[model samples]
Target: MPSPEPDDLKRLAERIDEAERKHAQRKKPPPPTSLGIAFRFATEMVSALLVGGGLGWGIDWAFDHWSHLQTRPWGMVVMFVLGAAAGIRNVMAAAKELNAEMAAKDLEK
Candidate 1:
Protein backbone atom coordinates (compact mmCIF):
# COMPACT_ATOMS: atom_id res chain seq x y z
CA MET A 1 0.00 0.00 0.00
CA PRO A 2 1.11 3.56 -0.69
CA SER A 3 2.21 5.68 2.27
CA PRO A 4 -0.33 8.22 3.53
CA GLU A 5 0.45 11.90 2.70
CA PRO A 6 1.25 14.51 5.44
CA ASP A 7 -2.19 16.08 4.92
CA ASP A 8 -3.84 12.68 5.51
CA LEU A 9 -1.81 12.14 8.68
CA LYS A 10 -2.83 15.59 10.01
CA ARG A 11 -6.49 14.87 9.30
CA LEU A 12 -6.19 11.49 11.08
CA ALA A 13 -4.65 13.19 14.12
CA GLU A 14 -7.45 15.73 14.21
CA ARG A 15 -10.04 12.97 14.07
CA ILE A 16 -8.30 11.14 16.93
CA ASP A 17 -8.30 14.28 19.07
CA GLU A 18 -11.97 14.87 18.48
CA ALA A 19 -12.82 11.27 19.30
CA GLU A 20 -10.80 11.42 22.53
CA ARG A 21 -12.59 14.57 23.65
CA LYS A 22 -15.94 12.90 23.08
CA HIS A 23 -14.83 9.73 24.85
CA ALA A 24 -13.72 11.70 27.90
CA GLN A 25 -17.02 13.48 28.09
CA ARG A 26 -18.89 10.19 27.99
CA LYS A 27 -16.70 8.86 30.78
CA LYS A 28 -17.56 11.71 33.14
CA PRO A 29 -19.78 10.80 36.05
CA PRO A 30 -23.41 11.86 36.15
CA PRO A 31 -24.63 14.53 38.56
CA PRO A 32 -26.37 13.56 41.80
CA THR A 33 -30.05 12.69 41.56
CA SER A 34 -32.94 14.48 43.22
CA LEU A 35 -33.20 11.78 45.88
CA GLY A 36 -29.53 12.15 46.76
CA ILE A 37 -29.89 15.91 47.09
CA ALA A 38 -32.93 15.49 49.31
CA PHE A 39 -31.11 13.02 51.53
CA ARG A 40 -28.10 15.29 51.94
CA PHE A 41 -30.25 18.29 52.85
CA ALA A 42 -32.23 16.29 55.37
CA THR A 43 -29.07 14.87 56.92
CA GLU A 44 -27.52 18.31 57.28
CA MET A 45 -30.59 19.86 58.88
CA VAL A 46 -31.31 17.00 61.25
CA SER A 47 -27.72 16.73 62.43
CA ALA A 48 -27.59 20.41 63.25
CA LEU A 49 -30.87 20.29 65.13
CA LEU A 50 -29.75 17.31 67.21
CA VAL A 51 -26.48 18.95 68.19
CA GLY A 52 -28.20 22.17 69.12
CA GLY A 53 -30.84 20.40 71.20
CA GLY A 54 -28.23 18.34 72.97
CA LEU A 55 -26.30 21.47 73.93
CA GLY A 56 -29.44 23.06 75.23
CA TRP A 57 -30.18 20.06 77.42
CA GLY A 58 -26.64 20.05 78.71
CA ILE A 59 -26.87 23.72 79.65
CA ASP A 60 -30.12 23.19 81.53
CA TRP A 61 -28.67 20.25 83.46
CA ALA A 62 -25.60 22.25 84.44
CA PHE A 63 -27.72 25.15 85.71
CA ASP A 64 -29.85 22.75 87.78
CA HIS A 65 -26.72 21.51 89.55
CA TRP A 66 -25.67 25.04 90.58
CA SER A 67 -26.51 25.86 94.27
CA HIS A 68 -26.15 29.64 94.18
CA LEU A 69 -29.42 30.62 92.55
CA GLN A 70 -32.87 29.10 92.16
CA THR A 71 -33.80 28.17 88.65
CA ARG A 72 -36.43 26.27 86.75
CA PRO A 73 -36.90 24.82 83.28
CA TRP A 74 -36.77 28.34 81.93
CA GLY A 75 -33.14 27.95 81.12
CA MET A 76 -33.87 24.80 79.24
CA VAL A 77 -36.65 26.45 77.29
CA VAL A 78 -34.59 29.45 76.30
CA MET A 79 -31.61 27.37 75.39
CA PHE A 80 -33.82 25.09 73.33
CA VAL A 81 -35.10 28.04 71.36
CA LEU A 82 -31.58 29.31 70.87
CA GLY A 83 -30.48 25.87 69.80
CA ALA A 84 -33.26 25.68 67.22
CA ALA A 85 -32.23 29.06 65.83
CA ALA A 86 -28.62 27.98 65.64
CA GLY A 87 -29.61 24.79 63.86
CA ILE A 88 -31.57 26.75 61.30
CA ARG A 89 -28.65 29.11 60.78
CA ASN A 90 -26.23 26.22 60.31
CA VAL A 91 -28.51 24.48 57.84
CA MET A 92 -28.82 27.64 55.78
CA ALA A 93 -25.09 28.14 55.69
CA ALA A 94 -24.55 24.53 54.66
CA ALA A 95 -27.12 24.82 51.92
CA LYS A 96 -25.45 27.91 50.55
CA GLU A 97 -22.09 26.16 50.55
CA LEU A 98 -23.51 23.12 48.76
CA ASN A 99 -25.16 25.32 46.17
CA ALA A 100 -21.90 27.14 45.49
CA GLU A 101 -20.05 23.85 45.14
CA MET A 102 -22.62 22.57 42.67
CA ALA A 103 -22.37 25.78 40.69
CA ALA A 104 -18.60 25.44 40.48
CA LYS A 105 -18.82 21.82 39.33
CA ASP A 106 -21.40 22.71 36.73
CA LEU A 107 -19.12 25.38 35.37
CA GLU A 108 -16.38 22.78 35.02
CA LYS A 109 -18.63 20.87 32.66
Candidate 2:
Protein backbone atom coordinates (compact mmCIF):
# COMPACT_ATOMS: atom_id res chain seq x y z
CA MET A 1 0.00 0.00 0.00
CA PRO A 2 3.09 2.26 0.26
CA SER A 3 5.16 3.86 -2.56
CA PRO A 4 8.68 2.48 -3.17
CA GLU A 5 11.62 4.49 -1.79
CA PRO A 6 13.86 6.48 -4.20
CA ASP A 7 16.89 4.24 -3.59
CA ASP A 8 14.81 1.14 -4.27
CA LEU A 9 13.54 2.61 -7.54
CA LYS A 10 17.05 3.51 -8.73
CA ARG A 11 18.33 0.02 -7.87
CA LEU A 12 15.42 -1.54 -9.64
CA ALA A 13 16.09 0.51 -12.78
CA GLU A 14 19.77 -0.50 -12.76
CA ARG A 15 18.92 -4.14 -12.34
CA ILE A 16 16.48 -3.95 -15.22
CA ASP A 17 19.12 -2.32 -17.41
CA GLU A 18 21.67 -4.99 -16.57
CA ALA A 19 19.19 -7.74 -17.25
CA GLU A 20 18.31 -6.17 -20.61
CA ARG A 21 21.94 -5.93 -21.58
CA LYS A 22 22.54 -9.57 -20.73
CA HIS A 23 19.46 -10.58 -22.69
CA ALA A 24 20.62 -8.63 -25.70
CA GLN A 25 24.00 -10.32 -25.58
CA ARG A 26 22.38 -13.71 -25.36
CA LYS A 27 20.25 -12.98 -28.43
CA LYS A 28 23.23 -12.23 -30.59
CA PRO A 29 24.75 -15.14 -32.47
CA PRO A 30 28.41 -15.97 -32.04
CA PRO A 31 30.79 -15.05 -34.84
CA PRO A 32 31.94 -17.76 -37.16
CA THR A 33 35.32 -19.31 -36.45
CA SER A 34 38.06 -19.65 -39.08
CA LEU A 35 37.58 -23.41 -39.29
CA GLY A 36 33.86 -22.98 -39.73
CA ILE A 37 34.38 -20.47 -42.51
CA ALA A 38 36.84 -22.74 -44.27
CA PHE A 39 34.44 -25.65 -44.03
CA ARG A 40 31.62 -23.52 -45.42
CA PHE A 41 33.72 -22.56 -48.41
CA ALA A 42 34.72 -26.15 -49.03
CA THR A 43 31.14 -27.34 -48.77
CA GLU A 44 29.98 -24.71 -51.21
CA MET A 45 32.66 -25.66 -53.71
CA VAL A 46 32.02 -29.37 -53.44
CA SER A 47 28.26 -28.99 -53.74
CA ALA A 48 28.64 -26.85 -56.83
CA LEU A 49 30.96 -29.39 -58.38
CA LEU A 50 28.56 -32.23 -57.66
CA VAL A 51 25.60 -30.36 -59.16
CA GLY A 52 27.52 -29.40 -62.29
CA GLY A 53 28.93 -32.87 -62.78
CA GLY A 54 25.54 -34.47 -62.31
CA LEU A 55 23.92 -32.18 -64.81
CA GLY A 56 26.71 -32.72 -67.30
CA TRP A 57 26.49 -36.48 -66.93
CA GLY A 58 22.74 -36.38 -67.45
CA ILE A 59 23.14 -34.25 -70.56
CA ASP A 60 25.78 -36.55 -71.98
CA TRP A 61 23.66 -39.58 -71.33
CA ALA A 62 20.62 -38.01 -72.93
CA PHE A 63 22.57 -36.94 -75.96
CA ASP A 64 24.27 -40.27 -76.39
CA HIS A 65 21.08 -42.25 -76.07
CA TRP A 66 18.56 -40.05 -77.85
CA SER A 67 20.59 -38.51 -80.62
CA HIS A 68 23.69 -38.87 -82.81
CA LEU A 69 25.64 -36.31 -80.78
CA GLN A 70 28.48 -37.52 -78.63
CA THR A 71 29.14 -35.19 -75.70
CA ARG A 72 30.79 -37.83 -73.54
CA PRO A 73 33.50 -36.35 -71.34
CA TRP A 74 33.56 -32.91 -72.90
CA GLY A 75 30.23 -31.92 -71.38
CA MET A 76 31.35 -33.04 -67.95
CA VAL A 77 34.64 -31.24 -68.34
CA VAL A 78 33.07 -27.95 -69.39
CA MET A 79 30.38 -28.07 -66.73
CA PHE A 80 32.93 -28.93 -64.11
CA VAL A 81 34.91 -25.83 -65.00
CA LEU A 82 31.79 -23.69 -64.84
CA GLY A 83 30.94 -25.18 -61.47
CA ALA A 84 34.42 -24.37 -60.24
CA ALA A 85 33.95 -20.79 -61.33
CA ALA A 86 30.59 -20.60 -59.60
CA GLY A 87 32.09 -22.03 -56.44
CA ILE A 88 34.84 -19.45 -56.52
CA ARG A 89 32.28 -16.72 -56.97
CA ASN A 90 30.31 -18.00 -54.01
CA VAL A 91 33.42 -18.06 -51.88
CA MET A 92 34.23 -14.50 -52.86
CA ALA A 93 30.74 -13.36 -51.97
CA ALA A 94 30.93 -15.11 -48.64
CA ALA A 95 34.29 -13.52 -47.97
CA LYS A 96 32.89 -10.13 -48.79
CA GLU A 97 29.99 -10.66 -46.41
CA LEU A 98 32.36 -11.74 -43.64
CA ASN A 99 34.52 -8.71 -44.30
CA ALA A 100 31.51 -6.46 -44.00
CA GLU A 101 30.50 -8.13 -40.75
CA MET A 102 34.02 -7.73 -39.38
CA ALA A 103 34.11 -4.11 -40.34
CA ALA A 104 30.82 -3.48 -38.69
CA LYS A 105 31.99 -5.19 -35.52
CA ASP A 106 35.17 -3.15 -35.56
CA LEU A 107 33.20 0.01 -35.93
CA GLU A 108 31.04 -0.98 -33.00
CA LYS A 109 34.16 -1.32 -30.86
Candidate 3:
Protein backbone atom coordinates (compact mmCIF):
# COMPACT_ATOMS: atom_id res chain seq x y z
CA MET A 1 0.00 0.00 0.00
CA PRO A 2 1.17 3.57 -0.77
CA SER A 3 1.81 5.93 2.14
CA PRO A 4 -0.64 8.87 2.53
CA GLU A 5 0.51 12.22 1.12
CA PRO A 6 1.49 14.92 3.64
CA ASP A 7 -0.84 17.48 1.95
CA ASP A 8 -3.71 15.06 2.14
CA LEU A 9 -3.02 14.37 5.84
CA LYS A 10 -2.83 18.09 6.60
CA ARG A 11 -6.17 18.75 4.90
CA LEU A 12 -7.74 15.81 6.73
CA ALA A 13 -6.44 17.10 10.09
CA GLU A 14 -7.80 20.59 9.37
CA ARG A 15 -11.21 19.20 8.46
CA ILE A 16 -11.25 17.09 11.66
CA ASP A 17 -10.32 20.13 13.76
CA GLU A 18 -13.08 22.20 12.13
CA ALA A 19 -15.61 19.49 12.79
CA GLU A 20 -14.53 19.21 16.40
CA ARG A 21 -14.87 22.94 16.89
CA LYS A 22 -18.34 22.90 15.40
CA HIS A 23 -19.33 20.00 17.62
CA ALA A 24 -17.98 21.69 20.72
CA GLN A 25 -19.97 24.86 20.08
CA ARG A 26 -23.43 23.85 21.21
CA LYS A 27 -26.55 25.87 20.40
CA LYS A 28 -28.53 27.09 23.38
CA PRO A 29 -32.28 26.80 23.34
CA PRO A 30 -34.28 29.99 22.88
CA PRO A 31 -35.61 31.61 26.03
CA PRO A 32 -39.28 31.25 26.79
CA THR A 33 -41.61 34.02 25.70
CA SER A 34 -43.95 35.75 28.14
CA LEU A 35 -46.93 33.79 26.88
CA GLY A 36 -45.01 30.56 27.17
CA ILE A 37 -44.02 31.39 30.72
CA ALA A 38 -47.61 32.18 31.62
CA PHE A 39 -48.82 28.94 30.13
CA ARG A 40 -46.20 26.98 32.02
CA PHE A 41 -47.20 28.55 35.32
CA ALA A 42 -50.85 27.92 34.63
CA THR A 43 -50.27 24.30 33.69
CA GLU A 44 -48.23 23.70 36.82
CA MET A 45 -50.92 25.14 39.04
CA VAL A 46 -53.78 23.32 37.34
CA SER A 47 -52.03 19.95 37.32
CA ALA A 48 -51.13 20.27 41.01
CA LEU A 49 -54.70 21.19 41.84
CA LEU A 50 -56.05 18.25 39.88
CA VAL A 51 -53.67 15.80 41.54
CA GLY A 52 -54.44 17.10 45.03
CA GLY A 53 -58.18 17.09 44.44
CA GLY A 54 -58.06 13.59 43.05
CA LEU A 55 -56.11 12.34 46.02
CA GLY A 56 -58.53 14.00 48.42
CA TRP A 57 -61.48 12.52 46.63
CA GLY A 58 -59.94 9.09 46.82
CA ILE A 59 -59.20 9.50 50.52
CA ASP A 60 -62.73 10.66 51.28
CA TRP A 61 -64.23 7.79 49.33
CA ALA A 62 -61.98 5.26 51.07
CA PHE A 63 -62.73 6.59 54.54
CA ASP A 64 -66.47 6.73 53.91
CA HIS A 65 -66.57 3.21 52.59
CA TRP A 66 -63.91 1.33 54.55
CA SER A 67 -63.89 2.89 58.01
CA HIS A 68 -67.38 4.33 58.49
CA LEU A 69 -65.83 7.85 58.52
CA GLN A 70 -67.06 10.80 56.44
CA THR A 71 -64.48 13.36 55.23
CA ARG A 72 -66.19 14.62 52.09
CA PRO A 73 -65.84 18.37 51.38
CA TRP A 74 -63.34 19.10 54.15
CA GLY A 75 -60.76 16.76 52.78
CA MET A 76 -61.18 18.19 49.33
CA VAL A 77 -60.86 21.74 50.62
CA VAL A 78 -57.74 21.09 52.65
CA MET A 79 -56.05 19.22 49.84
CA PHE A 80 -56.99 21.92 47.39
CA VAL A 81 -55.31 24.55 49.59
CA LEU A 82 -52.20 22.43 49.93
CA GLY A 83 -52.20 21.96 46.20
CA ALA A 84 -52.35 25.73 45.70
CA ALA A 85 -49.35 26.11 48.00
CA ALA A 86 -47.45 23.47 46.07
CA GLY A 87 -48.28 25.19 42.83
CA ILE A 88 -47.05 28.49 44.17
CA ARG A 89 -43.83 26.84 45.26
CA ASN A 90 -43.39 25.32 41.81
CA VAL A 91 -43.92 28.70 40.17
CA MET A 92 -41.38 30.32 42.47
CA ALA A 93 -38.82 27.66 41.67
CA ALA A 94 -39.39 28.06 37.96
CA ALA A 95 -39.06 31.80 38.26
CA LYS A 96 -35.81 31.43 40.15
CA GLU A 97 -34.40 29.15 37.47
CA LEU A 98 -35.39 31.56 34.75
CA ASN A 99 -33.86 34.46 36.61
CA ALA A 100 -30.61 32.58 36.98
CA GLU A 101 -30.57 31.75 33.30
CA MET A 102 -31.18 35.34 32.40
CA ALA A 103 -28.42 36.46 34.71
CA ALA A 104 -26.06 33.99 33.09
CA LYS A 105 -26.89 35.33 29.66
CA ASP A 106 -26.37 38.84 30.85
CA LEU A 107 -23.01 37.92 32.26
CA GLU A 108 -22.02 36.25 29.01
CA LYS A 109 -22.69 39.49 27.21
Of the candidates shown, which would achieve the greatest lDDT relative to the real structure?
A: 2
> What are the lDDT scores of the predictions, listed in order?
0.74, 0.89, 0.88
Candidate 2 colliding pairs:
none
Sorted by lDDT (best first), the order is 2, 3, 1
Which stretches of model 2 miss by more than 4 angstroms? Answer: 1-26
lDDT of 2 by residue, 1-109 (tens): 7877999989999999999998887455688999999999999899889888888888899999999999998888888888888888988998999999898878978
lDDT of 3 at 82: 88
Off by over 4 Å in 1: 1-4, 12-30
Please give, for residues 1-109, the per-residue lDDT of candidate 1 as tens digits. 8887999989999999999998887444566777887787777667766776677667767777866544456666776677677767876886797788789788987
User: Residue 46 of model 2: what lDDT?
Assistant: 93
Clashes of each: 0, 0, 0
Instruction: Please state the error at residue 50 of candidate 3 in Å.
Output: 1.1
**lDDT of model 2 at position 10:** 94
Question: For candidate 3, what is the lDDT?
Answer: 0.88
Q: What are the RMSDs of all candidates, in order?
A: 3.9, 3.9, 5.9
Find the 10 residues in a row with the least total lDDT in model 2: 22-31
Give the least accurate 10-residue stretch of model 3, judged by summed lDDT: 68-77
Cα-based lDDT at residue 8, candidate 3: 97
